[model samples]
Target: MASEEVVDLEHQNHNFHFENGPAAAIFSKATLPVTLKFKDVIYKIKIEKPGKFVKAAGKSEERTILKGISGVVSPGEILAMLGPSGSGKTTLLTALGGRLGGRLAGSVSYNGRPFSNAMKRNTGFVTQDDVLYPHLTVTETLVYTALLRLPRVLSKAEKTAHAEAVIAQLGLTRCRNSIIGGPLLRGISGGERKRVSIGQEMLINPSLLFLDEPTSGLDSTTAQRIVSTLWELANGARTVVMTIHQPSSRLFYMFHKVLLLSDGNPLYFGKGSAAVDYFSSVGFSPAVAMNPADLLLDLANGVSTGENGEDQAAVKQTLVAAYKTHLSEIVESELTDCSAEPPVAGDDRTLSRWSNTWVNQFSVLFRRGIKERKHESFAGIKVAQVLIVAIVAGLLWWQSSTSHLQDQVGLMFFYSAFWGFYPLFQAIFTFPQERLMLEKERASGMYRLSSYFMALTVGDLPMEMVLPTMFYTITYWMAGLKPTAGHFFWGLLGLLYGVLCAQGLGLAIGAAVMNLKSATVFASVIMLTFQLASGFFVQNVPIFIRWIKYISISQYTFKILVAAQYKVGETYPCGGGGGEVCLVEDFPAIKPVGLRGVSTAIGAMAVMIVGYRLIAYLALTRVGALKK
Candidate 1:
């Protein structure tokens, strides 16, 4: 599907024209030729992998991951990324892929265009993990993606046809219907899934592709086959850029170009065969017949302080010089006396991306959420927990009567308090897992965070309703309160409020804490403290803890209960005998007196929901916090 130009990079005016078939096909109604350029780029990471403090003592010690990295891969060229273990290879790939989370520094341009939304549209990235939906068949996965991304330009049938073509091109026919397996199943070989990952990018037919350790976790032979397939992919006019650790001789031979990254630095970036020769000329020759990849890697890692170190340093100096030379040439060529014409302003519709059809984006998202819940076993657990709560509430009901108003109020408070914390806790439990998936999808522009939040709320509605229904149904009927349906419904509202508030609160907690262990601790302490301060069944809150009543979600929900159910006409504290029209008139406005007494309860819930979501968004955008 054709996308609205997001960015139009004007490097330098070139009157180059392609009349031949391939060129004609690419530039169907072409006007000008633009070149993508990459200038001096560098990335670094702080060494905070734990125990480093003791190792470095009071002295400030730092470690570099990828240093002074720079490269430029134009359209129709494959830049093979190579490095060894701990050589900052993955770091470089991730930075280039725009997933470093924070620890990345570089300007990546396309056709001399900066890496903005428009440029990203023309680029496809294949991470090591085949992150396709596991349940969907290979064709189904790509077809769904195509339908979503290419709907404006392709009909359903056309989408399917496009997916099929990509499938054939990537040699996925043999296992097109098979599942892309994970830790549990072995549906296809590692190589096939890798191909599928690549094929996903092929669907976009992007002008540029970046891959991260694509061949890792696979057999040497399988890795080689995958690289060979990738070579074929690049042959079709895509600029395939991938980071690979140690390739076989044959695999190395297939590379059109290679970029060597070591210790967060670019050691080399040029032709594949020439890389070996380059290292050899600088006195870092391969051991007679050792793999060139291994030799370059050793040369990159062999830096030290003495004579041998000096030799390694000398070799590195040569490689660095070559990197600087290539980087300077590319930049110099792209930006020289560049006076480009004004760009054409065409389609610009960000909100039009919204899916408003019957098979709307929300509908699809809701379905995905439901599927996710079912897969995660949330539905069954919700039912089970509701049933258990119902049984327990029934027992509590069987023990009391409506005459015990104070005790009943206490019971309601306890239930409301429990409900409030339940959602928060569930969020802590479930949101973390979803956070990982969310990051991946968000990076790929799957949908907006609002869409995700909406889907989650909608998808979990049934399950969320179940628990509140169980709680309210059992408690309302057994307490033997007013028999009116209005009363019953209000009772339900009070219960559901607890649940919603909890959901928001839980999400907030998840966002604030980066790791599960820390999140768990934070959730535990906060929930416990809130429950205590909620005045669940306790009459007196410590003077010091009085403020919690204002902040506790349970306090507001319980107050809402009082405001919704209490009969002001019946009684109050008017300084008379038992029933001398004891009244302070109608109940105080739903303020400091009743459900509104929650003071900041609603605000707290809002803060939790919005604050956590913002934090999660920021965290997801971060590139290197994963290590932490």
Candidate 2:
């Protein structure tokens, strides 16, 4: 945290040098000193006004999130934006970072130029919530990020070296082997996790860094450490900008510049030590000794009944008006005096979007997906779910003779029905859970959506299939549906095919709804309707609604299972094998379709598989999964 404690990726010889070609080119040079400048940055969005009556609910209004925000953050200085909730702290930060979308009226430039791919390559943005894979160790997390984010000019070993340097700098070596963890699972501490998040962005040695609330949800000591690290990083001649909420006194002084905001208005933009004096001159200074961050937040929130005893609304109005009248001119004047001039369009900026080839992207994402999903796919609870259901169903229909045709038919249908919905529920949570991580990576151009979705499709399949294989391995011989290996595999294929279709359906519903509760209910209704039309519940479905059978994955899967395990003319002696009644080919419970229709039924499910998954992918695009 002190000057002596700086981690020298360039000076102290960390085995990798910044002078080394494109692989090492990502390291901050401190020579291309970036000066981030924004003038009159304004943002707004439309929201519907809540109405007492349903008919009036469509009435809309424009809500302004930011109003005429202006600031400058030069290299060797760390700028902190201070505000209470709803003061447009994040909106302004996002605009400065070039990630905000909508009707934005402002200009942001790097060294007095618009954002280009070159700036994107050297920029790092850290979201407030740490979006990380929980099962991966800290070392693994950084290593993967380095691989995906670092330019391909670096060898695998070189990327590892970069990661090691960051790990050492962030003091994460102690917890390098620990998993990142989540709410249900426990691994590293929160501060350590926060450090890992910061470490991820620091890997590229970015010239410009934007972090949202780097100190939120942290203890004072931990918060201080994070700010101190950023301070050291900025002293490396990397312009660092972040949003902070109610920082401690010691932590508040670490900032080189403070931009205060209230009600979408910039209250002050100047040195941190000068904030109190500025506010005092503006007639809102605190009367008692207190943390500057607290006083700033209080003033920003117009906390009344304090030393001023002025009306809160009036205080807020006065701050906004005073800032516009005084500081706005100063902001523009400073911008005018800045040494950096606007860059001519397409003159000297280096252009870069993706660092790796698409093939390599797929490979890296596939490998990472495997490592991240192994636990969720085969966790004790999920395995137990499949095993318990298999055991129960097998025991109930355990090795019944062919005479009990109805019970055997029921067992086969159970295989179709269970797998149909089991995988559906499991797959529904996949897209929703990864939404945060996906958006974060995509916004950073870490990988393409196609590559990521392909990896997800391929990576999850092999592991997902294991559940059905385990279930059938236990229940197949136990239930005695078919004895031959050929029959066993055929039935297994049908079940797996049905699983894929159901999973596709789940993915579509999840992407479209995006809410777990709503997706679950919608899927429940749809699958139940399919089950009712599966021919086991009733053969005489109404003609008007009979169309459900054609689109019903369970119905087609049931047809395949029946064809695989039964012969068209086979008869089963009923009444305890006494031949009181025989289950003929025309039995109401089983369709008379033979193996000849297997191809047709499989073709139908194949269509559903592709159709549903295609719909799912498109729905993901609609849900803003792809970079926009």
**Best candidate, lDDT:** 2
Residue 464 of model 2: what lDDT? 78
What lDDT does candidate 2 reach at residue 484?
96
Model 1 lDDT per residue over 1-628, tens place: 1233221211111111223421123212122222344445566545543454455444444565666556666545677877667777777666666566555555755555445544444456777766755555676676666554443333456556667777776678999988776676567778888888877665545556788878888898888777777676566555677888777778787887787766556777778888777665555565457677767666676642223536765656766776566554653554453445323212224323321233445566677567545544355666677668767766776555434455556666766776776777777666566666555555655466666666776687676666677767876777666678886787677677667777766766676565688887887787677666655545465788688766676666776676556644555443345543433223232223444333355556667546655665455345333221
TM-score of 1: 0.72
How many collisions between residues are there in candidate 1? 16
TM-score of each: 0.72, 0.93
- For model 2, residues 1-628, the per-residue Cα lDDT tens digits are 3322222212221223545642353334443568999988889898877667563565888988888888888888999999989899998888888788789998998987888765676678999999999999999999999888876666788888888878888899999999999999899998899889888887767778899998889999999899988888888788999999889999889999999999898888999999988888887767788888888898888874255566888888988898888788988988888897334222212233566668888998999999999998999998898889889988998998677778887887888889989999999999999999988999887887878888898898898799999998899889876789988998888899999999999999998898999999999999999998887888777899888888998888988888778766677776664666654456667853333577888899989989998888888887663743
Error of 1 at 280 (Å): 3.8
Q: Please state the error at residue 229 of candidate 1 in Å.
A: 3.2
Can you give the lDDT of residue 406 in candidate 2? 80
Q: Lowest summed lDDT over 10 consecutive residues: which window, candidate 1?
A: 7-16
- Measured with C-alpha atoms, the lDDT of residue 138 in candidate 1 is 74
